[model samples]
Target chain A: ELKVEQNPLFLSMQEGKNYTIYCNYSTTSDRLYWYRQDPGKSLESLFVLLSNGAVKQEGRLMASLDTKARLSTLHITAAVHDLSATYFCAVNTGGSNYKLTFGKGTLLTVNP
Target chain B: DAGITQSPRHKVTETGTPVTLRCHQTENHRYMYWYRQDPGHGLRLIHYSYGVKDTDKGEVSDGYSVSRSKTEDFLLTLESATSSQTSVYFCAISESSGAPHEQYFGPGTRLTVT
Candidate 1:
């Protein structure tokens, strides 16, 4: 079974501060995804990291994948109130099934 | 915004009643999936369909059943609603089982069992 673990499940940070959410997975897989969900809303895709050393950045959010270590990270460069949302990292178990195992998610609250 | 929509945006039902949630997609994706999200469990797949009439179980498929009669519709049925079955159900669609393709999620249906 593929397992995904995320750190600091609940994070409280001040606006303009920087933080990073870590996602570690068990088993070997190359496809990783980052998603963000606001309260009572659907998830929005943030980044898709396809290989080792692949990094994607949008606005203040940056996501990187290290397939050898079975780890992925979502880095927040400068937090803002609008960035307060729950972020999730998912791993695709490569095969014909293409099932995804997702981390529990990191709930971030940015305070001004 | 992948042209996927889940019906019954919010539903409140009594225990022991059967509830069916509908997921319709316009993207013509080859794979459709049903997932439930709870407080601490994140998102756990309930079922998935690879093609019309081709369905399979997921990690949490005990109380749920799914059917795909057409390429655009996937239905998730809760045989008997229970308090434990109450959660936000999300339907996702993917173009293929291949790598580097991301799944697109629907608006979600919030089901509450009383």
Candidate 2:
């Protein structure tokens, strides 16, 4: 069984601050993904990292992946109240179909 | 937002009752999946289907069953509902084409077993 772990399970940050969440997997993976979920809302895809050293950013959120280290990071820059939500990172190994093993999400709360 | 819909958005039922949730998609994607989310545990896949009449179990698939009689519809049935089975169920579809071809999720069905 593949295990995925995310650090800092709960985050409480003030606006205008930056923070980073880490995701580490146990074995080799074909790809990595980041998703955001708001209270009482469905998931929204944030990033899909295909290779090592792959980095992608959208607005205030940035995500990167390192295949060699089997780690991924989601960095929040200048977080706002709207950025407050649960963030999840999942892994797909060997790329068979789209089977993903997800880590427990990091619940982030940004206060104004 | 790929035209995925899950029926019975919310339900409250007693234990030992049978319930079936429906997922309908209009994108004609080849893969459809079911997942459950709970506190302290992120979305865990319950089952998935690659094609019509083709289905497989995921990491936590006990007490759950699925069927795909058509490409646009997938059904998840709980023969005997249990308290532990109460969770928000989600349906996702992934197309074969496109680069960022991640799973497009439905609004989800919230089931509560008392």
Across residues B1-114, which tens digit of lDDT does each residue of candidate 2 receive?
589999999999999999999999999998899999998899999999989999999998999999999999999999999999999999999886655658888999999999
Q: Write the residue-wise lDDT of candidate 1 on B74-109 in tens digits.
A: 999999999999899999999864656788999999
**Interface RMSD per candidate (angstroms):** 0.8, 1.0
Error of 2 at A78 (Å): 1.1
Per-residue error (Å), model 1, residue B57: 0.7
lDDT, candidate 1, A43-112, per-residue tens: 9999999889999999999999999998898999879999999999998874566788889999999999
DockQ values of all predictions: 0.80, 0.73
Off by over 4 Å in 2: none
- Model 2, position A42, has a per-residue lDDT of 91
- Considering only chain B, report the TM-score of model 2: 0.96
Residue-by-residue lDDT tens digits, candidate 2, A1-112: 7999999999999999999999999999878999999989898889999889999999999999999999999999999999999999999852667888889999999999
